[model samples]
Target: MNCRKVQYYLSTFSEGSFSSDKLSEVEVHIRNCKSCEREKFILEEILVAVRSLPTKTTPDDFNLKLFNRIYAEQNNPSESYLPTPESSWIRRPIGWVSALATVAVAALITMVFLQRPVGSPDLPLNSPAYSQVESTSPVSTPSGKHVGNRIPVSAYENIIGVSGSASNYRATNVSQVRTLRLADARVESLYVEMMRRLGAEPYPNMLRADTRYYEMRSPFARTGSNGSPLLRNAASTISY
Candidate 1:
C-alpha cells in the first residue's frame, strides 16, 4: 500500500499478475502518490517498447564451440586457456610472501633443534636428583596415583624456553611441602555418599579431583605476576 511497495510491483501490476484485492491496493497507492504514479507511467512505457521489439535467435555454432573447448581441455590439460590453481597462488604477492615466511620459520626451528649443543635433558621431578632432599613424602593425585614431593632442581629448565646450560638450574633450593590430603579425601567420600542418596552413584566425573598442596621452594622468580591469578602461578614459581 506504500509508495515504495507500489513502485516495486509496478511492472507486475502492468502485467496483471496480482489478485483483485492486491491490484486494487497498488492502484490506490499509485493514484494518491504523485511520485509513484510517475514511476508507474515510465514502467508501462518501457514494457510496451520491450514487447514491440523483435526477438533474435542465438548462433547455431555457439553450443558446438563451447563443447569443443571443454573436450580439448580434458584431452590436453597444458593447452587449456584457463589460469591454473598453482600458478595463480604463486602469482599473487600476498600468497607467495606468506608461503616464503612459513618456510623460513620452519627451517629456523629445524636448524635450532638439530644444532642444540647444551646440557643433557634432566630427570623427572620425582627422581632422586635433588641433593640434600633427605626425605620424600608421597602425595595422592586426583586419580589416586601417588607422586613424590622431592622435586629436583634439574627436573625442569632454569629458563623454560631458552636453549643453554643447566648450571643455574641444577642448584637445589626446595626444603618442604605441606598438603591437606586427609581433608580432601574425607571431602570426596562425603560428596560421593550425598550424591548416592538418589539410589545411584555420582556420574564418574562429578566428584572432587584436584586437591590443594603447597611447596616451599624459592631462589627468586623468573617471571612477574602482573597481578593476574593465571599469570600469578607461572610468574610466582621460583627456582635457581
Candidate 2:
C-alpha cells in the first residue's frame, strides 16, 4: 500500500514471484493513487532498461585460470585451501545421503544390464503349423483356401464387381496407389485388364505395387475460418 511495501514488491514483481492476490492489490493501489502509479511506471521503465542492457559473455580462459589458481593453492602445503570461519559451513559435507542414493541407482542399473540376455526375445507371430504352410506353400493365406496362382477365396466375389467401385475410389486416390501390398499386384493387373475391357481411362498409378499401407486423404473433414482442414493427414481406419 505504502512506498516501502511497493518498493519491496517491485523486485518480487520483476522476478514474477507475485501471487494473483498480491498482483491485484498492487494493480488497485496503482490505479487509485497517482504517486503509486508513477512508481509503477518508473519500475516498468527500470525493467525495460535492465532487459535492454547489452549482455557480456565470459572470457574463454576464465574458468581455466580460476581452476589453475585453485590447484596451485592446493599443492602449496604452507598455504591453506581450507575455508575461513565465515564460509566454513559451505565447505562441510552436506549431501552424503544424496550421493549414496545416486550410487545405489547406478549399481542396480549395472547389475540388471549385466543379468539381461544378449539378444531380443523371439516372440513368434504365428503357430508352427501356419509357419510350415507359409514356408512350403506357393501362395499364402490364413484361411487355407489356396486358389493355385488364382485370387484368394474372399477376393473372388470382389473381382468382377470391383470395376466401377475401383474406378471411382482409384480416381479419388490415384496419386497414393503406390502403397498397395505385394498380393495387391494381382488386383492391380486385374484393374488394368478390367479398365481395357470396360473402355475406361486407366489411372496412371493404378497398377503400382509397393508393399505399404494406403494413406487416405479425406475431403469432408472440419476446417478453420480460412477453409483449410483443421486436422492434417492421420492414420485412421474406415469401415465402409
TM-score of each: 0.25, 0.26
TM-score, model 1 to reference:
0.25
| Model 2 lDDT tens row, 67-100 | 4344345335247657545344335465465446
Q: Which regions of candidate 1 are displaced past 4 Å? A: 1-5, 15-20, 29-39, 81-240
Compose the digit string of candidate 1's lDDT tens values, residues 1-240. 778788888888999989999999998888888999899889889988999899997665444344445445643666877876655666689888866765565465445545643322222234232212223454334566444453332322221112111111223113211112222222333333333343333323222111111111111222333322322242222110
Of the candidates shown, which would achieve the greatest lDDT relative to the real structure?
A: 1
Which residue pairs show backbone clashes in model 1? none
For residue 142, what is the lDDT in candidate 1?
52
